[model samples]
Target: MAILEVGGLTKHFDIRPGLLGRLLSGKRRQTIKAVDGVSFTLEEGTILGLAGESGCGKSTTCMMIAKLHEPTAGTIRFKGRDIAGLDRAGLRDYRLAVQLIFQDPYESLNPRFTVFDLVAEGPRALGIWSREETARRVLEALSLVGLKPEEYKDRFPHQMSGGERQRVGIACALILEPELVIADEPLSMLDVSIRAGILDLLRDLSARLNFSCIYVSHDLSILSNISERLLVMYLGMAMEIGPTDRVVRNPQHPYARALVEAVPVPDPRYKRPIPAIRGEIARPIDPPPGCRFAARCPQAMDACRRDPAPAMREVGPGHFAACHLLDMDAPDSGTAARAL
Candidate 1:
């Protein structure tokens, strides 16, 4: 059974103008569709990668899943229970079961608190453990993240290196032994040299601890290596989703293809032409009808502009894409699919 399931998850932010502007505009409000109808299922002990460019709603989606942001519509089910409808006690339990790992460790960690206090905050807040028990748990968590509690527990965030601070952030999340972890660009702010170590630690810990994870980032190469499955999102909607290797090698959506092509090759001599995606990303506030990506899609046709947004279609085993070009009934559909 899937450990987490999100269906038609949507979050819209109301752009309320200032008093003067509102008076001039007669109270007209604009809505920014930060996350629109994103749906997916994550199996137990598996990692699902969410990849997209900046302002594409990756962080917003993660925040919604973490219950940091309330959704405008849709359902989030954890182990078959709707999170949105949970009562106070249930919500408290949910908070302990799910945790978020922020992008910037320095910013996320409380400088006022020592490493031991940071890791012990959750359990202490819930009043789930005795004073001595909290200390024991904090030490165990510090050890799990490769930090010796006796040596490092008394130190503040400023005392640690970037890599060590990130490990400390990870330990904070794991101290509660969360069942689901939503990691939002946890490696983006860290040094490149230490990224591999963090990734390895995450992989090892997830395997050993048996917790499901949602890893969000704009780094395609890293996601390809770390995630079991990949979901390519654009303008708050999923463009493609499939096995990591398959989607990285052969993306079905035009947006997904452009993202894959944009990855720089390590060899200086190898010069494959990068497929450039034309046009600026459309504004999310009151976006136009039909396919959101049609304005910039290289393969978009008149039908794409006139028709409603396309639904996800299975193009291969366990691979799905939301593109009008994948209309299987069309005569040229086979040709288009083959081109991908």
Candidate 2:
């Protein structure tokens, strides 16, 4: 069953000019489309990897679901209820049921708080359990993350290594027994050697604990290792989404194909092809009506530049992509490879 569902999830940030600039030029406020019309579902006990470039709004989409940002428009449904309409008590419950693991472990934790305090803070703040119970649960959470609670629970964030600190951050979310965990680039700052360990830990814990996960990363290689499904985004819009193997092995969108091809292979003997992307990333502010990726898409045509951005079309079983090349009726559809 799907534990979380999002539909037309859009977030727009408006930039208002300073009083002096407003007086000097009389310029209108501009809007930045951080996340535009994104939709996906997270099944119970499954991991969905959200992949995109840095400015493509993967983190922003997760933040909106975590309630850090009120979406400009869209519906976020968790467990079949609309979160936007939740009451204070309902929202509090939702918060507990959904926890977030931030990208930078060093910045996400409190320097002053020890491992025990950090992990127990959630339940303590909500008064979900007694002090004794919270401590017990904290130790359990630490152990679950592969940290020895007896020796490491008293250590400060500054005292721990990057990988250890990240484990603590995971423990912080796990302690809440949340049904959904949003890990936003959790391994981006860690040493390369330690990334696999953390990835394995998360995959193991998800199975043992039966929790759903939304793992955000710019790297499709990492996502292929841990995620059951993949959602590829570009310029704040979803380009393609499908099963992990399908998306990684047979990406159906030009942007998604570029992203997959960009992943470096380990073998030294293998020759990599030239990337298919070109031109600079289009500005999100006052974006044009056509496809956001048309500027860089190698398969872009006049229709892609002139018509409205294409809606996602099913190109295979459970696989969908938004690209004019997939439109069987378009004049130039046969000119480009239909695979994309």
Candidate 3:
């Protein structure tokens, strides 16, 4: 079942130049479309990996889903209710159902607070139980994430390693027992040896805990391993979304292909024919109309220059993508849905 659904979700960030900041001060200003027309669903106990470049609106989209940043426009429906319009009290309730694990463990954790304090904070905020009960739950939470109370309870953020701090962050969020967990690049900051362990821990925890997850990362390879489905975002727009393995193995969208190609081959015994994606990624502020990736896309066509493509289409069963070159028919509903 779809535990969380986001539709027509768009967020705009006001990027004011110094002189322009003064001129547009106290006035409606030009905006950066951080997350424009992104729509997707997270099924119960499943992982939906959102892969994109840094500043490609992945984090912005994650923030909106976490309700940390409100959408400038669009609907966020969770458990079939439009919680997007919920009030403060309603939002307070929303927190018990949806929790976010941030990317930077060092920054997300408070250096002054002990591990026990950090883990117990959410249950405290939500009035889950008495001090004694919350303390018990906190220790249990730490154990679930592989950190024992005796080992980590009194330790502060600075005393812990990067991986251990991140585990502590995960413990804090999981203690809430939220129905949906938005893990925003949780393993990106850790060392290579520990990255897989953390990913495995998150996957195991979600299955046992049964909280659907939205894992946001710039690494497509990580998404492929952990997710059942994946959404590819470029310049604040979804380029493709489909079953995880199909999209990663045989990508239809140029941007999706670029991402897969950009993944480094591990074995020295194997020589990869794929080349590194050339040119710099473009900014999201006032992105071009047609295809946002056309500037760097090797297969750019006249149609791509003329107008933007449509929503993801099924090239195979449950394997959909948004690209004009893959289409044989002219513009029609068959090609793409109207832009959200």
Model 3, residue 145: displacement in angstroms?
0.4
27 in model 1: Cα distance from truth in Å? 8.1
The parts of candidate 1 lying over 4 Å away from their true place are: 17-27, 328-340
Put down candidate 2 lDDT per residue, 1-340, tens digits, no spaces: 8899999999998888678857864776867898899999888889999999889999889999999999999999999999999999999999999999989999999999999999999999999999889988999999999999999998999999999999999999999999999999999999999999999999999999999999999999999999999999998999999899999989878899999889999998999998799866755876777889988877778878775688887776778888887785454533333444
TM-score of each: 0.93, 0.94, 0.92
RMSD of each: 2.8, 3.0, 3.6
Predicted candidate 1 versus true structure: per-residue lDDT over 1-340, tens digit per residue: 8999999999999998778857875767978898899999998899999998888899999999899999999999999999989999999999999999999999999999999999999899999999999999999999999998899999999999999999999999999999999999999999999999999999899999999999998989989978999999999899999889989988988999999998888998999786768977765877777777888888888777775788887777678888887784544553334333
Identify the superior model by TM-score, candidate 2 or candidate 3.
2
Question: Model 3 Cα displacement at 245 (Å)?
Answer: 0.7
TM-score of 3: 0.92
Lowest lDDT sum, 10 consecutive residues, model 1, at 331-340
Q: Please, what are the lDDT tens digits per residue for candidate 3 over residues 88-206?
A: 98888798888899989999988899999999988887787999999999999999999988999999999989999999999999998888899999988899899998999998998
Q: List the residue pairs that clash in candidate 1.
A: none
- Candidate 3 regions exceeding 4 Å error are 19-29, 329-340
Question: How many angstroms is residue 5 displaced in model 3 relative to the true structure, after the best TM-score fit?
Answer: 1.4
Among the numbered candidates, top lDDT falls to: 2
Error of 3 at 274 (Å): 3.9
